[model samples]
Target chain A: MFDYLRYIRERNFPHIWCSGCGDGIVLKALIRAVDKLGISRDEMVMVSGIGCSSRTPGYVDINTLHTTHGRAIPFATGVKLANPKLHVIVVTGDGDATAIGGNHYIHAARRNIDLTVLLYNNYIYGMTGGQVSPTTPRGKRASTAPFGNQEPAFNISDLAEAAGASFVARGDVYHAQKLEKLIVKAVQKKGFSVVEILSPCPTAYGRRNRMAHPVKMMEWLRDQTVPVAKWERLSPEEREGKVRTGIIVDVDKVEYTETNDKLIESLKADK
Target chain B: MKKKRADNICMMQGNQACARGAMMAGCRFFAGYPITPSSEIAENLALSMPAVGGRFIQMEDEIGAMGAVIGASLTGLKSMTATSGPGFSLKQENIGYAAMAEVPCVVVNVQRGGPSTGMPTFPAQMDVQQARWGSHGDRGVIALSASSAQETFEQTIRAFNLSEKYMMPVILLVDEVVAHSTEKVVLPDPGGIELFNRKQPTESPGEYLPYRETDDGIPVLARFGTGYRYNVTGLCHDETGFPTNNPEKIEKLIRRLTDKIERHRKDITHCHKIMLEDADVAIFAYGSVARSARRAVFLCREAGIKAGLIEPTVLWPFPSDEVLETAEGVKAFVVAEMNLGQMAREVELASKCRVEVHRLNRVDGRLITPQQVVEKVREAL
Candidate 1:
């Protein structure tokens, strides 16, 4: 029998992502978080949109919904609301989370439902070739933006905090252990939670940019971020080029299904 | 099963009957957004679902509502959503996904006038073609149309049953008039209504393959929890329910999906003919338009004209044989509907051009009246 305690699909090896892709690190962090938290695979569901990062669910031994392009959040929301006994988690890529699925992402956070979203921010639309995405840095080269993109990139964790997520954090592939701790914290929260992990895309993203090698991209990711506590101490000039990577929005509020459960209980009591 | 009597007759609006029928079919989850002509369904569901120990969510948009329904259905709960034309158009992508992934859910489209939001309060059968061919890819769809408040109730339950039986999305197509009208309906006893749930995997968790085709071409469904822990995707997949790139595997999957419905054509197509005894003229129609055609058939009989009516309750997997049988020995056909000859073209093609076809179409957010149908029949004559 397949073991539910160990949250890894042992038989399905040789996953689809290319070598040096940061998706593997993020996947390991997610499994470690769930495993460390003693969450049973039977009680967990991993939903993903169509992207390279979305493929993590297949290698994990959990109920997985690989939904259409940019629809993983709504699909995950349905699973959570339908059966509150289950813990729902979502993994999405830059294009899957911010561009096509932006509405569902923001609305899911705004509703403050109990779903932990592990957003793999790989900068480029790696699944469909190196197309420019909503998070692709302005003046960066992509397949679609041959002359460099003109639009500004989205600060995803900040966007999630603004969208009313109860717990918002940023982690990077450079620090896998720290990322796992953040994921564990997010999953333990009772309301909507989001963790944007800065993952590298050596295939689609690295070849086109100046960080053509995997080490160059890894070094770049390591140099760009600071803890949120230290980030606040820096001057605007110092913070201009740095990203604040830590818990950004954490608060206590009644979750969506809990309120709905109360409504049901009141309705039942009236009868 | 107890016999349904007239004393069981209760006054029910079309949408309310639909909601009640959904509850009877074991639908414990409903996710929807408010849209006219189908809003009462959501309203009634929101009020009644919690009382029945089910959950109801008013999603952020039509697309989310559809997506949620698929998700809930993956958990092996009977789930459904109701929408009108504009909303139904938005749901096309996920409905196609449901078809591809073999997800079982029911979609109720109380069709209204549309190219885009043509009418909010008026009736039209404009989405009949869209219901049949709206989604991308070669997909299987079971779309049922009901004419009255009573049929809308029974057919909705049937829609859920068929959706589970076929493991695909079933569309219950209604119009603004049928969805809004009220009439006395004899509610079926809980024991009398037939409910068909999806076939679950008999094998234990580790040995289960979600999409492994059975002898009947349907796979056993393993719900989201319960340790099955399988993957469900929209891409053309192998028997293991994972995306496949092999051309041969894709061809087999598509052929099986297509033939699963096409091979069961008789069981899926529900149709009826009225006053067709030795008839030479046939009025072919469905949905609310069938009511006008029925009246026109009666009026023609009083005038000593041998007129008949053929209405197919199941719009998709179009009732070709039923129309061909009704068209036998008939010379002219009058297709009456609330669109620009959408179904008329189907009837014409199904009849094999043995009889000439005429359309009495109305797109001004108005239903085709009995008088209008009679005029069209006379013109065809």
Candidate 2:
């Protein structure tokens, strides 16, 4: 853990996150994935839209951009297209990605651009005082929805898959090691990859519900989601509410940057 | 249409000239949406950008297009985007972001009539005010208006150079008339023209601070891939490029961002003055209306009235010094625009209530004619 100190920006530390926050765990899992991949820090470009998760770029030692709300995907697309050598990572929140930046997300996936997006789904807007997000579970309570959330929650992996992502996975912060492995696979993928990290936001969504404590929320995640094999083995009624955590899809496709590169080459050849 | 290397003295539209000028200025990335009057710029870049080892992408929306251009610019490539009123409105958020981040890029707005999608194919100079105060907050803006195809070509290159020089976004503002009109233009040879690239950091990654200011307010920019890993945020940040809530730091940062351009106002201001030396009545105009103002000056001269024109190519910094200097001698001013007295207010401010300012405004999405300007000047006379 001490050897990986170079990846962290210590000067910016004692981060502004709340106590017992799962955002830190997700950040650590990302750091471990990056370290394990052995990619040079200088070659990485981390970009994010506005939110608590977006602050992750500020605390990482890399070429980073903290952009406007729901804008990280398009910004990362520019970086990836301009310099294909630099690996682009997009860190986003549920509201940032699924609600406001939904167009950029689906288009980025449809184009199969080479970007690894780690979506930290705390099921609520932790920053800006706890509003219900697009991924907040149905009937969950938030500041904006004190009675209960009336909107249906999004299946993030399913959204990405439908949008033509080459790699799509869902992980829980409760299983940090396995989450880190999914991030590594996402990083290694050739085209647009999405890894949904079901992070606990005890300060926002959990407190309003029955799981007021961070431990309780973490335990809920552990009990609710099962392994992919076990999930597949269960009957429809038995598997009703369990969220499966693992890589859902992995395949090869021509990345958007390479397609543009080929076009550039041909245009020059014709010239 | 001529694809030859030694092509010159060829007929071209103003939008095509702007696209060529952008190419001449070493812009390698273009991201734009298809919008009326300005769509030709995107069409030209779509075919030409790839041929020159550049990239052109038709993004999902104007905001995304602006976002992509900024992204490409950060990777050390000169990038640009073109749009009309509706598209331009959508791009304001990112344009403000570019201003706050000090990202060097160009945004070309071919003006049209609009409160919201009002007129698409018609000419209007209504965006003159929006160009400066369109984006939120206090920041310096560089906007150039072109009256002809040749001027649009030259101004596009100037826009890119000014953007690179100041490390901020520059706007090449034209109207439907200027954008769609075709004329014979000679693109300057590349050897004869000088281009400026961004200045890079002297130190390596560990020792570098991306927003460290020099004597001039411009900071040394490090592109994404060259290993000077640093942070860029829309939030008020310090020299280390990290967000800071300190009031002192925020004040200093914003002042420097603006002071860098305001201090260089002399170099930034570019205008054309005709017969204003000994004239009592002067017509203030820009973009397509400037053409009508020139003709009005000709008719006024024919009528033996001492009417001159103050036509500004650079509109944002507003050429306040020149306007004030001209206001000293002029008795009354006739301001002509496609909209109702947007820029005339600035003319009044520069005049300091010394000269009588008359506005000849139009909002029917039609070009303000030379006769109308002549009539307005006659009324002022």
Q: Which stretches of candidate 1 lie over 4 Å from their true place?
A: A1-6, B1-7
Model 2, B1-381: lDDT tens digits are 967675768899999999999999999999898999899999998988888788888888888899888888999999999999999999999999999999999999999898899899899988888899999998999999999999999999999999998999999899999999988898787889888888988786778888886888898879988889889999999999899999999999988877888899999998899999989899999999999999999999999999999999999888888988999999999999999899999999988988999999999988889999999998997
Evaluate residue A122 in candidate 2 and report its C-alpha lDDT on the 0 to 100 scale.
Answer: 86
Top candidate by TM-score: 2
- Model 1 residue A211 CA deviation (Å) reads 0.6
Candidate 2: lDDT of A257? Answer: 85
Candidate 2: chain B TM-score against the reference chain B: 0.97
CA shift at A65, candidate 2, in angstroms? Answer: 0.8
lDDT string, candidate 1, B97-156, tens digits: 999898999999998888897898999989998998898888767999999999999999
Candidate 1 positional error at B146, Å: 0.9
DockQ for every model comes to 0.76, 0.83
TM-score of 1: 0.97
For residue B129, what is the lDDT in candidate 2?
86
Candidate 1 per-residue lDDT, tens place, A1-271, comes to 4244366776667788888899998887787788788988888999999899998888888888999889999999889888888999999988998999999999999999999999999999998899999999999999999999999999888888898899999999998889999999999999999999999998899899988789999998999989999998999999987888878888997799899899899988999
- CAPRI quality of model 1: medium
